[model samples]
Target: MLRNRLTRISAALCTLAACITFTACTATSEAQRQATASKPPATDCTAWVGADRNAMLPGYLLPRAQGTTGNAKGPTVCVPLLLTANQPPESYAGGDYHISEFTADKLKARWRDCKAEAACFQRVNAQIQRWLPPNKARATRSTGTVDPSGRIDPEGQVDLRKIRRPAFFAKAPYREGIAEAEGRTYTVEFTVPPDAFERIDLKKTAPIKLRGWYLEGTGVDDGKGGKVRALALMAPGGGGQLTAIQHPDEVTLRTDAKTGKTESLKFPNATTETMGQRWWRENLHALNQAGFDVLAYDRRGEGLSGGFSDTNTLEQGEDVFRVLGQLENGRGLRMLTPSGDVLEGNAAAGRLLAGMKANEIPLVLGGYSRGSMSTAWAMTSNYVASCTFDLPEVTCAAPRGLRNIRGAILLSSFASGAGYVGDAPDLADRNLFLGGMAADHHILFYPTSETLAGMHRWPAAFFGKGLWDRAESLEGTVAAYNRIRGVKEIVLARGPHSIETWPESDRRYLRERMVAYAKTVVVGGRTVPGLPRERMWKDFKGLVATTPDSWEPSSRPRTMEKATEQ
Candidate 1:
């Protein structure tokens, strides 16, 4: 009987051991399941097949100035690709191609005639090589010097390290090659299915549904013989409302002033061609290549976006708030129209938002001319500060004050409305109020000295010379913002009222300043190099006192009434 009791006790112990093992395994599996559920889904790119050229690739056509003409060219096709961890692909030269007229048509015909996937890929690659060859001259080598103590020397004349063979150059033997195939234009090719090529119609009017992973290289140094890498998935571009969760819900309808009929507003979407052109014009893509996820879009009624182009500050603030909310929550934004139309949100956009949030990317809001006002209003408006958007089963809160914004770039800003928009309030007081509210964020202002000249030549009807002269002087504006800890103003020696029309040197300077400021304030959390900080206000005041009497408004009293009427 004792032997029987021992056997029963041993069996009970074995049973308990098995139960504990099973429980542990079950818990681990459940944890993994939860993690997988929270992760964003992979993007889908099958809808691009048989889509219109514009719908498939928005912003392909260049925006021509009035009365200006160019050689007739065929439709440009831009294929977005996915990038690898390796350096840029062998086919890419970090430049754009303005192919001769009809070159695009021949390329299109070749793409249509190709039967096999490999053949099609080869054809496209060949055309790209023929028309847009890699620019070897533009390729730059990483050059820097190091001291004996292993610290980087900013003033060193010679590079201590002999690795001048391009930092991205792979050393043979240990070098890991780029995976899969390389796109003819960029580093990595989008893993698009072969069959999708046959389905692309190019002539269809419907928008293409394409999504893929894209790696944008930002040539920022890691302070230790390495470069910083940042990636952003490409969003669909064109003249329509954004369906992606990464984008804000766009206002679509507005009453036409002439007919009083509610009509769709058009928004400009950045396409590959236009993106390249913009890179050439504004160096915007260079900013992306420099490590920032640049999201260039037209405000509600501007560009190709469908909506009443209204400049109501409150509505603009609301729109910016929704975008901020989407970025924070990784969710789609719900936009209710004045017509009571509830436009549904997109899941893909939410996934993109989730990815950005997961990466902990910061935002830098920037604008030029009227856009400056929009950005400023967005920062200070009550609507944006307190607004929230309803996601599908979740509530996404808007940014509190300027909490999410790390910096603001106001180029040729009319925030003060001092001399241009009519008998407006003192711009100096308005700037002080807004600047105080965003004390923690960095603000960079680029005011022009040749605004009077620009107004007399091109925009004279809208902007009076007196108004332009006063606003562009930036004396009061600088003094008002000088008290803010992060505020800094740069007076361009001679630049047009329109930032877009500024010379290449001026534009380059602005880009460098912007990048440097972003690096100092956001990445390094330090003071900007070469900036006069508190001393600029006093120095500028002295300069104003010594300036010619002609620059003063009192010297030209006759124009004051005319300026006020505007």
Candidate 2:
């Protein structure tokens, strides 16, 4: 019966497509068909388990061979979690895959039916949340002011003119990694110091630190017709320390130039931690080594900073803008027009730096992936010098309001598959298994040099070499920059996706070009230059190992040479 239902859905779609050529209709029909076929038939309860049902089970991974020689295998059974029925409807809408609750009897039933231990275990894997069914309710970026209790308060004023107070400004630390998908949650506990307390009642305070997923719902409507929502933090319930998972330093560097002042915001990847924060830590080093004095912080939900109910790309960009305004050098720069209205700023950093000691400084903004999007959006401010890095995959206002950027240093990055190309030849074959090599820190491709010499500070082991293929192309991102006339250069590098792992030579070359360009155009009153066409490509070729004499290949796991005697 289940199969019949799916077949009927597919047939209906085909018939609908034949009748209407309208894009939306055709698309919707096809989507419906795909959804039905892709999902396990709801009628097949014999092979199905829901999220709540699986949670009662005893494991997280599918059964596998165990012991030194290997306990070879077990029964092979298929247990599919009917996400639509098993998981909560709200969870599906909120981008959460956790089964909200489970009962002990359900676990026993699931286990008894498993053909193999692996099948039972696989049913409960929390990681499956990352692979949610398509067309399901998706989470998008949204923002509202957080209240005195660390709860989201949309009615609060965000006027820059007023000395605003941040609610729940305190520290909460906890164990790094603990697995409890169903009810796992962290409560942020902190206080709003009286001195910093301007608008809110001083006596009120609440939790700030947390990890896991949250949902948004309208409770209090901010007067402007915008409804308020809370980030549904999934916590089993308790008091725990919210340890800083990643602390990103947001540095805005400015150089006095003959023409005026130039400023650059660099977001260095985090370099402090080992296993847990590898992606973030490496990003800090990559941006730092690349010459960006990045403006970054522990994202609201991650580091030691305040907790947020919900955050999206646009919100993050707004936060970046807010930080730039708060800088010492950013005062009185004029964020809006004389007309008193504008999302884009004429001298966003300058206005933020107003009344400060530093004056006439030009600013450059850059970020990695999400951070890069923040940088791109900053270009809309007239005070900034340049905007560069991976193109943000999210929506952002154009760079139209800012001064003509002197240059852009984009890394292995992209926002879509349409324009992206596969890996360059040299980068495609480089060995990624170098034992504890610093190459991991670089995240970008290795230099074409004979050895992995200066690349040691990077952590290359965390990713596979296949990822290099995608990093080589920016998926035709240059077209986006071309829209901003007078933009100096767009330098694309080879290697892994992140720029930090690029060869030192590549790093230095790009930085030299950016600084020189900044000095001439924004400072020296000279024409900004573009990267000489072949510079980026030539560097990519150098990473390839053509002969045995080439740099020693990165190390990898070796198979046992001979069978051990049992």
Candidate 3:
């Protein structure tokens, strides 16, 4: 009705204004407006274009400016949410709100105290209202440290140890039937299950190895042919000590729908773990099953791997360079557990190499959380500092760029912004989104800025995150997905920040999807189902409202509902 009324109004205005003019007015106006959205006053549409390109600071969770019609100083032009995502915001119920009145040091100490035994820790979390925190932005945090418990004191403090004992029903699950994968997202890795992957196929051989300081997973069909197809190396989450992918058979128990009790029901396989073992067993299996020989290594100083290391950004990236280079050369990360108690897993599989040269193989690399950051930066800092690095999609992932790389898989990826897209104080007047929950989603351990600028350097990429993830922001991941200039796939499924927290079915599908994405781009050299790809972001001074033929649509501003937590 509004569009029809506008059409009639435009016709009336054209007719009324035609009496005083000699040429077609509305036609000229229509021609001047390049965007499909409502027309703005400027014939050039400069305000709309400018706002669209730079003003949508979604990282801050503030609303785009919606212009008013009668302002004497000209309209405060708006920019619609431009990036598209795989799912809508409603896929997740508003996450649970749990308060942590202490610091991470204090909280992690509690997990360590509990031995990570489900029953023991269940005792510790009695007073906590839920399994996860909303990660909302703080109005007045003394420090910027974001925990899963965004419910913080002024000093950026959260103490889970303080809330111990008593009632069984005080706390609710993030969702019944769904269990957290990494447990608290913020929970310390007090326990890690090694030998995490079980052999899914015996016909084609892949091996698990215990080299000196490295734990490795690698293999291909023995002498079966064609360059082992591809090799994908995945790293674990930075915070957890999880060494490898979880096996598919392992289960996570879910609470009964009627009651929020953990042990209420009789179903044994209540839920299959999404992430952090079979270390993400299914993802590892999917890639391997798709003919991509797989490798997963523990970062030095953490997991079972030896050697002292810090959480420095480039250090992890350097690890990739070492691991990938080693695999390419068919070298192991030192091999074996002192010759006796077992020549197990990959080592047990015997002579793991496929007898193919490095050039014959295509390389794909990735990881869970901070691990993904390592891969992204490694690709960035390797070379081509001044060039666009926009290789064609065919040669993009493989047969091109640094190290004949095929692609990257960034699960729980970094989307956009530096600090937080969560709520801020005194800024309620601005359109705030998701109540700033998950503001601490994948909170930064270091101070580097957003990595979106360098993501174009990546080849065929697959980005996945949960709908109600407390680990990373959904909007930011979508931003990363939309911004990548090459073949990319975004899988936003129903779950929390922890993939392991997702239902078993969703986990299985995602694992399969990862490999399928890899196979499509890695071997066949094609893009998968995805949103429109974009190249230029920061400095497009050209007529953005008119660039119609490219992957990016014309930037047109549109009105937005008042974004508030009603």
Candidate topping TM-score: 3
- On the 0 to 100 scale, the lDDT of residue 333 in model 1 is 34
Ten contiguous residues with the weakest lDDT in model 2:
232-241
RMSD (Å) of each candidate, 1 decimal: 28.4, 23.1, 21.7
Candidate 3 C-alpha lDDT tens digits along 307-362: 22323334455455554444334344232222222232233232222434444556
Q: What is the descending lDDT order?
A: 3, 1, 2
As for lDDT, the candidate ahead, 2 or 3, is 3
Off-target runs (Cα >4 Å) in candidate 3 are: 1-228, 239-275, 308-310, 327-333, 337-360, 383-403, 415-447, 529-566
Clashes of each: 18, 70, 35
Quickly count the clashes in candidate 3: 35
Candidate 1 local distance difference test against the native: 0.29
Per-residue C-alpha lDDT of model 1 across residues 1-566, encoded as one tens digit per residue: 98875564443333222212333222233323332332222322211101001011111111121111124353211211111111224574321111111111222333344423665545444433321111111111001211112122222221222111111212332121221111211211011111111122112232111111122334355456665432222221112111111011223234444643333333223211111123122333445556654443333332212222223232343455455454345243332222223332452233333255522554555555545555544443321222111111212232243443555555555443222221122232222222211121111111111111111111001110111222333332332233123534343412223332333444565567655555444444445566433213234223222111122111122322221110
Against the true structure, candidate 3 has what lDDT?
0.36
The 10-residue segment of model 1 with minimum total lDDT is 456-465
